[model samples]
Target chain A: MTSLMTPKYATVKSAFWGGVREAASVPMLIMGASFLGFGSMIKDINWSISLAIFTTLSTWALPGQIAMAEMAASGAPLLAIVLAVGFINARLLPMSATLLPHVRHPRFPGWAYYGVAMLIAATSWVGTLRRLPDLRQDQKMPFLLGYGLLLYCGSPLFTMAGYWLSGSVPLPVTLALVFINPLYFMLLFLQDLKDPGRILAVLFGAVLGPITFLYSPDWTLVITGLVAGTLAWYLDGVLKARRGTDES
Target chain B: MNPELYNPVWVITLAAAVSYASRGLGVALSGKLNPEGSVVEWITCVTYALMAGMVVRMLALPIGALVHTPDWVRFIAVLVGLLVFFIIRKNVGAGVLAGSLFLMFLMW
Candidate 1:
């Protein structure tokens, strides 16, 4: 008889396949729609289909990919393009680091981290973090690999679809497709508002983001994130201390 | 060298390298940081805030075709989605579907 401590899956193959199955749901549609928009945008700018597919494979982050396209089109220098893409994707650093603890296992190969790190898009990061706790420790890494692989491979196809269907699709529908990504993210954040620090971060970001964007559109996300997050962290700390004192 | 003069292949190659570097650096750093420590908590908070900022920017000041829709229409769709989300016990997929359809309806 299997104990409660036993993992749901007996092997890595099962876990990985399970992850692929899990990903063939709403999250997959959200990512598909985003890439579809991206494919069309690249076509609109007359960029090659191969290059567009490469961006999905290599950069793997939507915002950075979009920034690279826009910057390149405007004839921004190479260094400028590099810096813009780097800063836009800096969130991946913290997100990957946070995820490491949850997914690490001794049986998992060390070299695989570098390869899998390429899959750390906002959707994968959030989905993995949210789901890992419910999974057995041994299952986490393989599951992520399965989930990431399916999306990573399937995204290029979606991009190609968007590229071919660009002018044929109605403009308003294409716009709505792009809008789904952010709308999904907003609702997901709302669903996860049980923690004070998280709640404060979202509230503060919602307030400070647009105001800061007016002055520095390129750096607004990082700057607003730093200031609002730090303030929320500090305030949450204070609230925790007060609660502790009251309990005492 | 004039920054304006560059090859497209080099641009894609360099951009990919820069993007991957951020993720690789995080993977390297993750080994050293204590998961339960204050540092991780701080990073978590920052990540959340960063995501929130991205979401707000996309909604309030969208680019491309989304720019055509009136601001109030987008905001109303969000409000409607939120209502449906709460009414249905925080179903994320439902919320997104409701909001997207509503936006399409308003913009249609």
Candidate 2:
């Protein structure tokens, strides 16, 4: 939810409407298509529809869920698979925390965001950040809820379609579907970079994580986020202060 | 049984429970932490930095399907997407779509 104090913004109704508009626009389509591919993967691998839907409802984090599903398909141990997926998603805690305070209604103190957040994903988080800054706090949650529900319902259908496509689809086409998941999110971040340090952070994190993963896959994200995040913050602060001094 | 062929219902159930509990943990912690405070402010910055790092990491070093795309191509697509996103007033859907389609068209 965004701060209502902002001078100009959308009403709760309008914000949710924007969410609908955004969800249907491009991200949803990409997600729908890719999830269709994922569904195909699920079915081809013989995971039940129930399991796939359960993944949607339960984990909700598409990247991690996909990792879990695909790794499991390859005969990875349940614990190891879950751990790997969980490790990837550990960034969500920070993602959620950074996002929640910016939107939690100061007046509506009793509202519980847990249930709503339980359904959140990397898609919705990126989606909401893209919209909610100019909306009221109250409007923020509803916008996310509406958008998430629409996207959520599509998962099973895509899964069913993907399962069908997996068998007959040519290898190149199949590769395109698989690529959509990460590509979808990556492009969103590129658009959202306002701070120069974030640009640096992205470069460092991206470069370091893979290099580190080659040596130790498990600790790559964890180590990269801490070191890289701190560096980004420090750099941003330094640059901002320098700008402030010049202005003064 | 080849584990992939059949997941015991318990595995699904346990995974769901754990996942939900992790989120609930975030909400509970949020209740205690004041968002406007200095530490929390710092944490928020850290979160953004971390998320940025993660995103960059994914583009720079993808695990599965993304690894196949050449690095320079991926980087250009992302940059193009960012340029479009800002040009279009920070529309996330447009930014990501343009970037992806750029890569898709070139690669395809």
TM-score for chain B considered on its own, for each of the candidates: 0.73, 0.68
lDDT, candidate 1, B1-108, per-residue tens: 332477667888888888888889889998675655666567667767766876787789865556788999889989988888889999877787788778878887
Q: List the residue pairs that clash in candidate 1.
A: none
Each model's TM-score, in the order given?
0.78, 0.64
Q: Model 2 over residues A14-114: C-alpha lDDT tens digits?
A: 66666676687566776786677566556655767777777766676666665566555546566655554554565466556656665687544544676
Pairs with steric clashes in candidate 2: A1-A103, A39-A159, A40-A162, A40-A163, A206-B57
lDDT of 1 by residue, A1-248 (tens): 32454336778789898878878887788788778867876776678899899888888887778767755664666766677567657767777877887888887789888778988888788766767777888899988988888888889998898888766777666666666667777887888799898899888988888787677665666677788888998998999999999999
List iRMS (one decimal) for every candidate: 4.1, 5.1
Question: Residue B42 deviation, candidate 2, in Å?
Answer: 6.4
When summed lDDT is taken over every stretch of 10 residues in candidate 2 chain A, the lowest stretch is: A1-10
